[model samples]
Target: MDVKRIVLLISLALVSYLMVLQWNQDYHSPAPSVATSAPAPSVTTASSNAVEDERLHLGEAPTPAAQAASPQALIQVTTDVLDLRINPRGGDITYAALLQHKQRANTPDQPFVLLQQDNQRTYIVQSALEGLANRGRIQFQASQSQYQLQEGQDSLQLDLAATIDGIPVVKRFVFQRDSYEVKVSYLLDNTSAQALETRFIGLIKRDNSVDPSQGEALGMSAFLGAAFSSEENHYEKLEFDELRERRYLSEVQGGWVAMIQHYFVSAWIPDAQQTNLYSTRTDNQGRNIIGFKGAAQRIEAGQQAEISANLYLGPKIQSRLEAAAPYLELTVDFGWLWFIAQPLFWLLDLLHDFLGNWGWAIIVLTLLIKLAFFQLSATAYRSMANMRKVGPKLQQLKEQYGDDRQKMSQAMMELYRKEKINPMGGCLPILVQMPVFIALYWMLMESVELRHAPFMLWIDDLSMKDPYFVLPILMGASMFVQQLLNPTPPDPMQAKIMKMLPIIFTFFFLWFPSGLVLYWVVNNVLSIAQQWVITRQIEQQGTS
Candidate 1:
């Protein structure tokens, strides 16, 4: 086989391997059997019963009360970007829908619900003060059932108060405009003529239900699980199966636990100064529970104490998440190429800010990448041009040594040495750049900012595949053009296979996100332009 055919086969093999690897990573074996139990009560509470303490020590099974759908009033709170409902039963955030992000590109009126508690599923953020009898079971009274951020208001605060054993406890939720993080504070007033000992337990309860968006794509499913961070392990994923078998127990000064799904997340970030116990369990309703319990604090008589934590409920915006907590940005996963993907996303974002268009920004970013590797591509193109220049001579040598494999190989090597050509030089440059291209592909696919962004006519929603296969067709055309400008294989079979690659790639790209296809098309066009210039220069020099 000729050099071009060999390169084509290698490229196809590489792409196939990557596709299989990605498929395995995204959709592994089904999770282990679902374990149903009630949410375990806290052991640090002073009023815990003997059975509760033994269960906590031996790893408790979920209680039956967790599955009871008892009726309770929900308080609605609306901010600039978020619409939320807090359950007064335990001050749990039961429902949260992002007002700015819609459920689909075509549906502007419907918002994306990130957290909710319904008959089929339950996902909520909950926190309660431990040590009091039935703290999480107690009822709290709110000032109002509904609260909205007024016009021109920068922030809004809602308070829920409950008197437990004469200790007045107030749960405050502070929502800010243009932000997804809610500041949750638990204030305890000790007015019973004695010091009160208590600790705060914050957790997220989510059922083992899949997101509707997970089935939207043909290739890979989005990651859905429980993840945590600590000083020892920067980030760790705990699936429902793992929680079922055993609890993930850890003690860290500052860490967070989160329930992450496609495009969005909800985490409980406790105070950084105090030590907290992070763990996970399964509820009786088959819901997964991941959370942290803060260390105990004493409140003197007539004195007040406040413990606060931040609840993040929104899309996985990397910059904002990083500001919220360390390594939190990692929720926007890019697989193993995070180092390269992160910087690529930064550049893409920078370009988007300057160009104000995601599609155009992708094209510009591709151009910049090509320019950065101009020298390497020029060398590869020069090598290909030389091979094309000597194509006739190589053909003559093959015919001269017909039916003699050893002689043909020797003659081709002799010819290559005489012509000062490196048979492998062209492939080296492409191999060196494959990682970056793959990284960029993943970065674009995982970016939430491009979810519903539109480019121009006929190309809306950069995150989804093209409604029509126009971009993929243009990409294939560009690829064919690029092949035409490069050296052709002497072997008939090899040449035919190389010619079929564009067709195969077009079909493969049809399912890819339009933003990624746009990048590939732009890169191919740029490569063709550069190769044309270099090939012309080489041909002229050879004639001279």
Candidate 2:
């Protein structure tokens, strides 16, 4: 009936929603296996040939020692946006760093490493041929180890050559300037007397290491495992622990499999024209592998066949991901309410483009959201205003019905009925807006554009918490002011707890992303302005 009850209901609703999310993360069942019109080969069958099985098992040969044997063995390729290392042993991308994204806010020189193969952790992209034969250890030889994109160069190409069963195979990686997508093509010049039946396999293998890209403590857990796009589902998350239970197998056309962390992702997108077999399994060393095997291509004697797929290894930029493959932008993972979140982000980005500052954009977005919900908020404020106007009557009833619980409730209900007030009107409107608020929270937390994005003075990175807790303090102050505008609860205990809501929320928000906190602060300020005006208007009319 009063501000305290509304606040309590909102708190309970938020907590219940978060608990549901956590529950889904822990115990959510996996989707049923998706099958295409044509049957794709199984993992074992894909590598069924004895010769292919020996060489195709990924993460096996190119031991850390072998990969670390010499710098010459690792080919370094640098583009405008990417710095990557290719191991010549199996033509796998051993290391990939985003040249444009910093690892930490304070360290501008250190780039964020997305994939690495060192003693500390093993997360790398690998490619293997599934039907090749006659191989001791396929060692690729590069023309030159270090390749850099020149100032005028728009693209760079690095080719690693190896011979398998007298066939010359060239693993070519093409990198474009200012782009994170790499075209990995395996060119097989089959000069043997027999036809070669081989499938191109692309795998992303990584250990269960904590995501280094995760920001501040006590934040919502970002998905830290594998995901894929299928014809049936646009995006499906496959947690690392889920892979341990049973391998994920799906056959689909025009799909991609990726390893996603907080702000970064690496996906292998096969050709969209053919059916691909996608699977996930833990290797011998307890590393999770999610990859796809393209349809088998038959290369006749003395014929040349080129099998290629696109590798996206960089920050999860929605535009870039969408350009790389269909439904790849869903990797942004804005939760279940993406339909709402998507438009919210679009508007936010548009505001950013106009304002040229993320902080200002957030404030303006909050104002716009408030305006859109003006009618709903007005209904709530009017209800609270009416309740405040009858404060003395409620107090009188409490005093007259002291220590008599039934009489007190009856008096309150009768008074509400006479006043034509709905006790639930204030809470229901807010409960309706809870989903949008949560969606915005996820959008802000998961947006790579906001990472290290500066606002104005004192707020250097919107993705991180406020360094000095200034915004959170201001947020608490705004909430306190809002409480002042609304009628206090008649119950003593309820009033006490309601008074503490601001402080409690302030502490919880101390660790949240500054961008999200900014939104809340602005929303609260706007609500205070609106409620103050309505309460004054209602009071003046009542007095008159």
Candidate 3:
């Protein structure tokens, strides 16, 4: 076997392993449903248990206040890109729908709902003052049940106020017209004579809800779990099973905890300047809670203090997330090839900005990559053309040295040395470019911008596989043509395997996203053109 065949086999093996791993991860029997009841708000009065200095345990259920307040109403907040419902009880975000992203490509009117607190699925953002009271559970009062950004208004604020133990605490949520980040703050007025100590804790509670996008494609599954970053580890993913076994704990000056799905994510970004303790745990109701607690702050008598945090609820747009917090863009994961994939995605985005169409942008990106590797490809093609010229000589040697394996090998080496040809030359260039192709594959797979993007006729969603499979068929044909241009191996078995590759790849590409297949089709067509030209040039020189 040649180096090229060895490399191809290894690549195929790695891909098969990954596919099995993904299958096992996605197809496991579903875990039993956790109860979806919201926990009662805990009140920490002067005589209550002294709060832990920095640690926030999951198993500790705070004592509910004896005095039960009236049920607060739910407030609705709307902006250009987001429509959210906030429950005044605990001031938790009950529902968030992204207006810009639709649930289906054909159904543009239906917006994608990211966070919903319902019987079927329980996902919410909750915050509270750890030592004094559970602000998330307390019944705060909102002035209005509905708030919207009026014409010419750039920002809107929804305020919820409550007096806990004579301390007036105000929770404010600020929303901007064109942004998905909400600024959440707690304004505390300490009127008592004694100093009050408390810590601000923000958390995201979610059940292992099924991802709606999982059934869209066969043998594909997007990540659905909790992820966080800290000073020790830049990014860490905590699966639901792992959370059940052990708690995730870390202390960082500034970091974030997020619940990430396929296309969307919601996160709690704490104050950047304060050292916070982050942990993840499951409540008695079986809801997974990933939260962070800020360092304790002492408020003197008659003094006021404010604890602020940012909440991001929207699609996984890399640029916007990076602008929101440090290392936030890492959420758009590209696996181990991020270094190459990131640059390729940037170039694709740049091309889209110029071309104004994702399909054309992919073609242009493929053209540019081919141009960049033209010289190396030309050398590879020249080597193959020379091998094609010596095909008859190799066959004759094999016939003469039949049944003498050592003599056949010696004759092949002597022929190659006399012709000054390198058997591995063609394989080296292909090996060098394989990583670039794989990186582009991942970039196309993860980009949410292409979710419902249209690309000419019959290709409406670039993120989904082609409905008609036309691109994949053309891609297979192009691969066959390109293979025909390359010199056939002297070994019949190897040549037969090479011939079957195009058909095998075509079947594989049929299930890939249309955008990925389009890229491969364009790349193969360009390679055929380049190889044909080089082969013709070498043949004419030999004739002369």
Which one wins on lDDT? Answer: 2
Please give the CA lDDT of all the candidate structures: 0.80, 0.82, 0.80
Task: Tell me the spans in candidate 2 whose CA falls farther than 4 Å from its real position.
Answer: 1-7, 13-56, 59-69, 133-137
TM-score of each: 0.89, 0.91, 0.89
Report the C-alpha lDDT of model 3 over 77-178, residue by residue, as the tens digit: 999999988877677787889999888888999998888866577787878787655333577898878899888999999989999889999999999988
Question: Worst lDDT window (10 residues) for model 2?
Answer: 32-41
Give the better candidate number (1 or 2) by TM-score.
2
Candidate 2, after superposition: displacement of residue 369 in Å? 0.3
Compared to the true structure, candidate 2 yields what TM-score?
0.91
Q: Which of the predicted structures, 2 or 3, would earn the higher lDDT when compared with the native?
A: 2
lDDT tens readout by residue for model 2, 1-544: 4453766666666755664543444345244232222122233222223223322354344445664535566889999999898878778788999989999888999999999988767899988777552243368899888999999999999988888768899989999989999999999998999898988889898887777887553246788889989778889987876776656677778799999999999999999998788887765566777888888899999999899999999999898999999999999999889898999999999999899998899999999999999999999999999988888999999999998878888889899999998877777788778888888888887899999999989899998889999998999999999989888889888889779888877876776778888999999999999999999999999989
Clashing pairs in 1: 37-62, 37-283, 37-284, 38-62, 38-63, 38-284
Give the distance in Å from residue 399's predicted Cα in candidate 3 to where it truly belongs: 2.9
Off by over 4 Å in 3: 1-4, 12-73, 134-136, 213-215, 218-221
Window of ten residues with lowest summed lDDT in model 1: 50-59
CA lDDT for candidate 2: 0.82
lDDT of 3 at 145: 81
